[model samples]
Target: CEQVTIIIIIINPGFVLVHFDISPASTDDPDIKQMMAGSTLRKVKSHSWKKHRHFRLLEDGLTIWYKSRWAGRGHSTFSVSDLETVRDGHQSELLLSLSEEFPSDQCFTLVFHGRRGTLDLVADTPEEAKCWVDGLRKLIHKSQTMDCKERLDQWVRDWFTKADKNKDGQMTFKEAKTLLKMMNVEMNEENALHLFTVCNLSLCVLEQHTSASLMSPLLSRDEVWKVFQDFSADGERLLVDELENFLQIEQGEREGRAQELIELYEPSEAARQQMCMSLEGFQLYLCSPHGSIFNPDHEQLHQDMKLPLSHYFISSSHNTYLTGDQLRGQSSTEAYIQALKRGCRCVELDCWDGPDGEPIVYHGHTLTSKILFRDVISTLKEYAFKTSVFPVILSLENHCGLEQQTVMAQHLKKILGEILQTSLINGQVPEQLPSPQDLRGKMLLKGKKLGGLEQRSDETITDEVSDDEDGEMERESVEDLTKDTADSNKQSKLSRELSDLVLYCKSVPFHGFEPARASGKCYEMSSFSESKVKKLTKDGKGSEMVQYNVKQLTRVYPSGMRTDSSNYNPQEMWANGCQLVALNFQTAGLEMDLNDGLFRQNGGCGFVLKPEFMRKTDSEFSPERPESRPGYRPLRLSIQVLSGQQFPKVNQKEGSIVDPLVRVELYGVPKDQSRDETSYINNNGFNPAWNETLNFVVHVPDLALVRFVVEDYDKASRNDFIGQFTLPFTSLQPGYRHVHLLSKDGTPIPHASVFVNVSISELT
Candidate 1:
């Protein structure tokens, strides 16, 4: 007799008294959730909760209260508790009715947790409601007690008996995915592999063990659960190792899959074009109409560090420098010459469309007819021809769409290509285009469909920006696809570029109010665009590209942090042509300290440093890399940092901590190192710990050296060392990527304070 059991999970709390603002997130049945939570639910934006009502957020489940008497005896506790009573018409009264159905001094609280902040309700009126809650809690706990293995075993035997109709042992990916969906985990290719590999890859290992293994082929149903029980530590679905195991194919198969996957990736050149045309990735917020084709006022900057621009500035809504004079003005040719004279490598040239549809130089969005492209080319040819390379980038302002902008970009690319080709024939941009794809290949379409955000968009309701912290998040997902194969060579190359740009790369500095994306409501829940629509849903977290046996970081990246649409990877974007991605430190509670890539043990700049690459076979990046895998090997780098940043934020939505003293964290730093040019300063030598206090001396160098640290890993001293870092030294090197940290170990405590003194010149 198949016992199809279902747990009776019903709401029994009678007198629900919520102190905070309560309302219906639902339109159809606005009163349902509040009614179910309690009989009397009070709500508003912020609640002035009263005495006698208490609230507490639990780690395991929800906590709520039911009020039997508004004037009952009880004192308020902390900031998260109830203090004043709130009445919001019928919702509160109706919600309080639930507590009316119960028997009166054994108080309990109900905490309703959503994706963001939680809601707390109190009921001190009746003791009956508390008793009911206690009973219901126990029931809920017992329902989840059945082990997955026991459950798996039952299903296996049943499936063997049923699918066997005659009982067959083998289950295909299709069958497995379906079975998993019924169990609540919707499986995709990577997810499926992750689950099977992470949970139980031994099934295919040389020592592959399963009940079927014991039987030497045809397996019985119950045996499946037995194997699950053996490997699962806490009986949780799958541990990280288990996930790794699921993808843990045999030596031969792993290599073959890597090769096949490599071919499926979008090319690097395609990615760069996608980024340029990727209207959303790099959005320009113009507070005022700019440039009418004015000559760029070229200024000189110190070129000791490899920052190519001797002196360049971008005019935006937000001023990059407090001192307006940090960046000077000059004509395009003069700016190009001055930059070249100062050993500069890159400069920004503003482009505008003229009335004739010809693109011309001037920092303006549009000119009388449209900027004429020929004028700018003539200017460059007459003056810049002699220089080996002009560290110049054409920044085109558009008042139109892809259909119109593409032509302008094409003209500019043509001009630059001709100019650079001449310089290279004489000596410029490294005779060979760094990555052929970046320079010669065509850009691919990042098939974007403009539509309303899907239902499960990341919620910003409770994730408000805080003044106390930078509010950034650490690493979201890590995909362990690095098993040795021939593609590793290519992947390594791309990863390095991506790593450098993300970690070491420096973005152009603007000397005006660059209207923040936040002000324009551009971002939805930290990532998705409110104006930009999601047409095709993908589930690889936030990733936009990926492929095997290729050396690009974008192809291997996991997914978006906030979206639920699966199967999207961004690794290929880096491998392709994209250069920059707009990221915010506030989202993760990290200040600008951990913003750069290479981490130091001097400041509380908790971030991922550059990752070391591995080649399963004998791997050394010599003159060139071998295209085929010499061996199939996997490598691991368990970095142990002595020190780094403190207060690298966590999701307050998760309610882990506002700014815990010693929280272990990790982040994803870029693989490239070309952008690392910064000064390093020595500060207090102490690291962060749970209780130990470390003193810091304040000092701001030109560039910064940053790092990330996780506490309580191994020894007693470990906690204090997590996220410790040093300030940048004045003697900075070119192409060095270090981050300037806040005043934790440095003198001034906050990052803004340190940054306020430095101009656009210091940061860029």
Candidate 2:
């Protein structure tokens, strides 16, 4: 015998209100809100392929979904948060290629953050294109301005939307269990039910009837509620007093700031009037920028910029023309634009004579494609101060003859115009190199000069000059030229007009530290190969090198043997207080990651002030032995890996989950360089918890960079990289925090983070 039974569960109305309180992003622009209806545009992959695709902004206003008409069910989506900016008209290569066929007004480009490829789109009319461009810009601004809590709420809402397969706005126990698994939790049925029941009991009343209905089950929301209850005297709501206690005790916030937070985060008018916060309001407060892991005080221009140029480490790039290997690669102005956009204040240009008396920039004697020097100059003039207003150093390896060099000088003076620093700043030779603030919006050429600063502009003196000091030679041709110049003192004719433009950064031969200091010529700088610098540092000259860099500048570049455009670790050069440690900026790896991390502070102005000890001309600080330095204090850093959220899968195969592990690395002085990793969490990439602690003793916290790396654990072979984030140790905010992870190309991974507890204390 079988008896038919039906169970009905009713959810509390309060719970429903709280669950749906996650509102869509609001905008004053009606055109942006109308984007939810979508439009059909031509997606341009190249000049040949332009497919009609329907594009729509989701109701959340954060994501955009697009699909071709032929693809009935297949679609692609990207979040507005992933975009860097939007370019109207033919700003991209693909769009420019289509300019002959399509009007510039009908074209636009979507530039994504990091290394993500740009999306070129063509609208039916200029009005349609403007609609999309303006709407997307407004949405991107909203995404950027969202508070931390709102971002987390959006993140949770996105997960709920994905978990709700039937779109019923309610989740059953079965669906809840599936959601847990999808979130990378391997919990038993009993535990899952217990958690679900506890969350329901706290928020609503469940009644038995014919049908069962419950509010969506989000584990993060439950956790927030639990945290809220801990601070609430009566688990129903948090009063002003309770909220203040939580802020001061847990978040290290100052006293009397709770009321400000309540007014800012509380969504309900009644709650605001009563000075009380509901669960939703409490959750919002917890996700706000005040609760973020990164210290908000450091997000703006906080560092001093009045110091001399040699007192800071400048962000620089080598072979800025080549986007690939040194031998065979495409040299385009786009490479310069990308580097400049990334805050590279120093860019290298290898000039060779081209047809029609024009000079071209490329790797000399190599098969790399060439870009006209005039075009490059135009690009530099346009983008030099886009990302940063600091002075730009154009490191020119001039291999062109007199006529072509004169043409190069003409283009520089014509295109760059007033931005070019032709002579001294105050009509007097500077005792020290001018500060970045003093040289703001100025471009300085770094190349060979004909005569001394006091010499007349028309005076030209030929000298044996080898621009290969940084090992710019790639093939036998450059090597033979360098050999001939060295062996027979062969002299290359200098263009007097071009030579007059060289002022601050005159490339001079380096003999020894004693002679350089004796000359006291702060304007004269030298470039050394990475190998040469490494040898000098290792040969017991590290302290001397540090002192020498206090007034003069030193630029270190990669060895010529790196034909593949690989980069040496810039930290090694920076450790000696070398200002311009140029690296292959196109390569995405640990080297570039470290470079980006160091320059990510002080509003990413491309110059970071060196440590005090390294800046003092009379002080002695060596990277090899940091303990002996004055005011040396070793500190203990403890990081507790609590859990991960929405880790992107490294393997794209269906149903493939990752066993993720974390590695915490400390890069600085030799004594402080160490790494510690946590054990892998098997078969889970989302919401995996390790609860493991990694410790390090940092001897030079000011100079140290802490990197957090997440990788997919494979026991049979090498672990695959997932994502990583690196920041200076001084920038770390100690408390329970979330480390937002970045992709290999240094772009933020949407909704991906590792929650941890960080503590720093003086070593006993």
Top-TM-score candidate index? 2
The true-versus-predicted C-alpha distance at residue 413 of model 2, in Å, is 1.6
Lowest lDDT block of 10, candidate 1: 285-294
User: What TM-scores do the predictions have?
Assistant: 0.22, 0.85
Across residues 1-764, which tens digit of lDDT does each residue of candidate 2 receive?
01112222435422222122223445446666657778899998866788899998876677899998889889999989888889999887667757889899999999887756689999998988998999999888888886654555556556656666676556566666666666655667777665556544444533222112232443354445656788999998889999989877766778998889889888789999999888877755544455556676766678889988999999999999877888888887878888998899999898999998889898876678888898789889888998999999999988788899899999999999999999787899788889999999999999888666765656667666454442222222333433444543456777988989998888777888888878858888888888878877895578988998999899888877788888888887888889999988888999999999888888888999999899897968988888888899999999988788778878665446789999999998778789999999987787787889999999999999999999999989999999998888988877667788889998887767787778889999
- Segments of candidate 2 deviating more than 4 angstroms: 1-42, 45-75, 160-182, 187-218, 221-288, 463-490
Candidate 2, residue 575: lDDT: 87
Best by lDDT: 2
Candidate 1 local lDDT, 634-671, one digit each (tens): 21211111122223332222212222232212222122
lDDT of 2 at 17: 22
TM-score of 2: 0.85
